[model samples]
Target: MRNLTQTVTRWAPTGTDAAGDPIGYTRTEILGRWEESQQLFTRSDGTEAVSRAIVYLASDVAVGDFLLQGSSVSASPPSTAWRVEAFRKVENLRGTDSERRAML
Candidate 1:
């Protein structure tokens, strides 16, 4: 059997705007998977944008376990929410025997 591990990190905006209006955003990063690879998507200022998403996998992350941050936007809330528009695979590490071996 093959042992597979995956981790995702996401961010979103949750706070009041300049006029004290509620707003939010979202983003996600996935590792050790084929369909969803290393990529980060985000929406800021009510606009959507895509950028290179980088991630590192360690033994600390387990399935169904997620780390989240949240706070007030006006006061530079330590926890901000971002909106996720889309995701694409920029790099994949799982392939044939030789490719897998090279990764190790």
Candidate 2:
């Protein structure tokens, strides 16, 4: 679709075959919007904590496997890596293939 939020790029970490063979780098394409959220909370010790997460639409290809937090998605060059904290399934997005939420 023409109105996709951003181009999600996946960089697969090296994999090993059953015979102990090496699998080269693999790149895949996923489309979604990467957003940053912050929440402030007070602890019992009166300490403040800011929770940050990069939220995005889950990828149909990854299926939440072989995905690490250090990887990231970018619309252009100079990307930033985000940690994968949690994932939740959300309403089906328009013009998208998956209906899940990813907390990076």
Candidate 3:
């Protein structure tokens, strides 16, 4: 399988509790090399937690270069549920598949 680099761009919470405080945080993680198609993974932590992975194919990138990124969330409260949001491409990196895909 082809490989690509993935990066985390944003991670925040969504919704609010009765006290008017944010119930949880939502996270948007990006994966891929610069100048290439990038994949995005969105996850949330709250009363209703959710997450998803998206693949983006850019005009500059080849079909095999498109890689999807996955994500997961861990909460202090075990009762909180985690769900998938959406899957899409967000950014792109550089280097060969082996180089870009390697996580340091």
What TM-score fits each model? 0.21, 0.44, 0.22
Give the count of colliding residue pairs in each prediction. 15, 1, 22
The C-alpha stretches of model 2 lying farther than 4 A from their native spots are: 1-4, 14-25, 39-51, 61-79, 91-98
lDDT of all predictions, in order shown?
0.32, 0.48, 0.33
Candidate 1 regions exceeding 4 Å error are 1-4, 19-51, 54-104
Best by lDDT: 2
Please identify which of the two predictions, 2 or 3, would achieve the higher lDDT against the true structure: 2
Report the candidate with higher TM-score, 2 versus 3.
Answer: 2
lDDT (Cα, tens digit) per residue for candidate 3, span 1-104: 13335442333446667877657654444554423233333232223322223332122221112122344443321232222243233343553322212111
Position 103, candidate 2: lDDT? 50
In lDDT terms, how accurate is model 3? 0.33
Error of 1 at 23 (Å): 8.1
RMSD of every candidate to native, in Å, equals 11.8, 8.9, 14.2
- Residue 71's lDDT within candidate 1 is 24
Q: Sum up the clashes in candidate 2.
A: 1
Task: Identify the candidate with maximal TM-score.
Answer: 2
Q: Per-residue alpha-carbon lDDT of model 1 for 1-104, expressed as tens digits? A: 13325543433345558986546533344333223243434433355444332223322232112222222323222333222333222234564222120000
